[model samples]
Target: MMRTRPLKVALLGCGVVGSEVARIMTTHADDLAARIGAPVELAGVAVRRPDKVREGIDPSLVTTDATALVKRGDLDIVVEVIGGIEPARTLITTAFEHGASVVSANKALLAQDGAALHAAAEEHGKDLYYEAAVAGAIPLIRPLRESLAGDKVNRVLGIVNGTTNFILDKMDSTGAGYQEALDEATALGYAEADPTADVEGFDAAAKAAILAGIAFHTRVRLDDVHREGMTEVTAADFASAKEMGCTIKLLAICERAGDGASVTARVYPAMIPLSHPLASVRGAYNAVFVESDASGQLMFYGPGAGGAPTASAVLGDLVAVARNRINGTTGPGESAYAALPVSPMGEVVTRYHISLDVADKPGVLAQVATVFAEHGVSIDTVRQQGKDGEASLVVVTHRASDAALGGTVEALRKLDTVRGVASIMRVEGE
Candidate 1:
């Protein structure tokens, strides 16, 4: 019953991920054909460099003109691995117009303009799959989109970026300062030369936006996500975390409000108890913890990024889109029916750990306690260390609105007894 005629596939971008996609498509052609019920062909590969040799790819099929390749009217599928916005967006729109499905791994593009791209695909009656967009090969998108379609997901917490996680993990295990840990990560190739995007939490914020949208069936954009970098995490922070039996990690958190009318998405460095599943997600690994009405708690963990791991995700999407092409059908499209408003960070309620440098005096503690009382913030625990007329007060507060916590910290800073605010960290995974 398998069709003998081949289904033409056009590949855009032949860099790390794109190259691996091509390699897998060629090496597993027969298996793919059998599974998809039709032979799949790499009709053309679009790249910037034409003279460079592609080991498993035919030289005649290589072209520098990506637009021309996607414009081909005969292509059944277009695999876009070119990250970023510009040409990727244009080429994807063109591919849809020219009657081809798209399987992309562009997280930034999807987080920024997913609705528009989804509209284009729906207008052309094409499938747009991006399993490789979020957590490398962890299979997060499809599960949130399809497998959990019948279930109501309430919260998704994860360590989405490997670079920040590696840096933070080093800080936790070795008691290194932020710069020292980041330097080690850079030398180990876990971090890029610039490392701005990863270290600044922009990368995790983009992923949080995407995950929030799919998990909540809502429209969450990149700008909607509240992001906080890990640059300020210090060795003293790790020492405090150890005292509390916790570890630090850069986490992407997406949750639906109690009323079920609104949602929130944020990325920040937090201290999670060592007993939590996510706290054990060390090194460059990624893990997402999902809580739903029926499923209770489910965790997805694995390598979050790498050439081969990300390429594996891309290829999975390729096979899926290819099968749909053979069946003359499309997979699930965008599901923004909820249309929930994304809440701002001020409205988010969570616990906080605050450290303060204060004058070592009896009445200073009472002054600090009054500030929390004035702001209606309940203190869970307080630890004080004294040395030569100066003392460090570490206060861990219970669940309170971020606005309230910010107010308390501001008031504490203005107090005559308080010398400085050492660090303020959000405590999670209780």
Candidate 2:
């Protein structure tokens, strides 16, 4: 039996994602009502520009006062697409206090202060679902939170940011330098005007923090994840990657230690073998690879971002929260029972590829080899090419602590024969 009375929903922010949420709500009202067992109404839409025409939204429902809209006391659900910290945080807590569930797409807010927001929702006995927060419409959050609840996830590796992936993909295919690739990405609208958030790995790091928390059932913050931007990736780096049957990608990696006592999260540009599934991911697409105890390897791949794609995720959460409202129940809340300490970058063990400019002399190689030996870092392979009075030595090292690798590099830099450190890249996906 379906309820005839409508469930009121308040929408905050009517920009790209918010507008689409409204459009879908109206256009699919009949279907949503049937699925949710009650009619859903867009009671009000909060926006900065109330006078601007929103195509499918009613003018009467528009308001500049978002705070008042969420506090209307009749709303069953509040869809927050306003991506930030301040008012979004306050408004969400307020919405729960006023008897409404929240479906948000604010990754930054969640990454920074998810525990507090989750506490607020739990305090008010309301559902807090944010499926659109990570990897756009790929359905990562809910799966990690619900579908894989019974399973033990050990590692999560992904290309989370489309902008950086687009730029790196261009550099790999066209052999263009970082600047040239970034300019192309900007022109194609794949990158923002400032592009710092995407290019500098901040965007991916935020997503990594969120994914790490849920996957490991731990509390991982944005600052906990180590971040390295892709701005310094050069065409020569890609050339070396080709020589080793690999390609470069900006990856977000989250892992639980072997004993399952600690976890680590990081974002950096790495060289993955062409045979790896992630290496084939091109353009602005996103893919996440998960390894668990029961489920050996699972991959989720799709369009990571776009108004429509992200809006699709938001709407899916809307339907879920709406159904839960009708049933008088809540979905899964935060699960930080593990509470694993996030390990620092120095403790992370991984392979490295280092390139060095040295004097084309006989004993220069011995000196470079000695540095690695002193640091207890084993060498996998070494390739040295002579050009006039100078030579380039490319060294691929075996698995070693990041601290050891850093020490080895520092020692090499002080050697008189070492002219310059051309590049140092982490190698992964073996």
lDDT of 2: 0.93
Runs in model 1 deviating more than 4 A are none
- Candidate 2 regions exceeding 4 Å error are none
Candidate 1 displacement at residue 41 in angstroms: 1.0
Candidate 1: C-alpha RMSD after superposition = 0.9
Pick the lDDT winner. 1
TM-score, model 2 to reference: 0.99
**lDDT tens digits by residue: candidate 1, 161-271:** 999999988888887889998899999988999999999999999999999999999999999999999899999999999999999999999999889889999999999
Please provide, for model 2 over 1-430, each residue's C-alpha lDDT reduced to its tens digit, 9 standing for 90 to 100: 9999999999999998898888888889999898888999999999998879899888999999999999999999999999989899999999999999999999899999999999999999999999899999998999889889999999999999999999999999988899998899999889999999999999999999999999998989999999999889999999999999999999999998767789999999999999999999999999999999998899999999988899899989988998898888899999999888999999999999999999999999999999999999999999999989999999999999999999999999999999999999999888
Clashing pairs in 2: none
Give TM per candidate.
0.98, 0.99
Shift in Å, residue 375, candidate 1: 0.8
Error of 1 at 426 (Å): 0.3
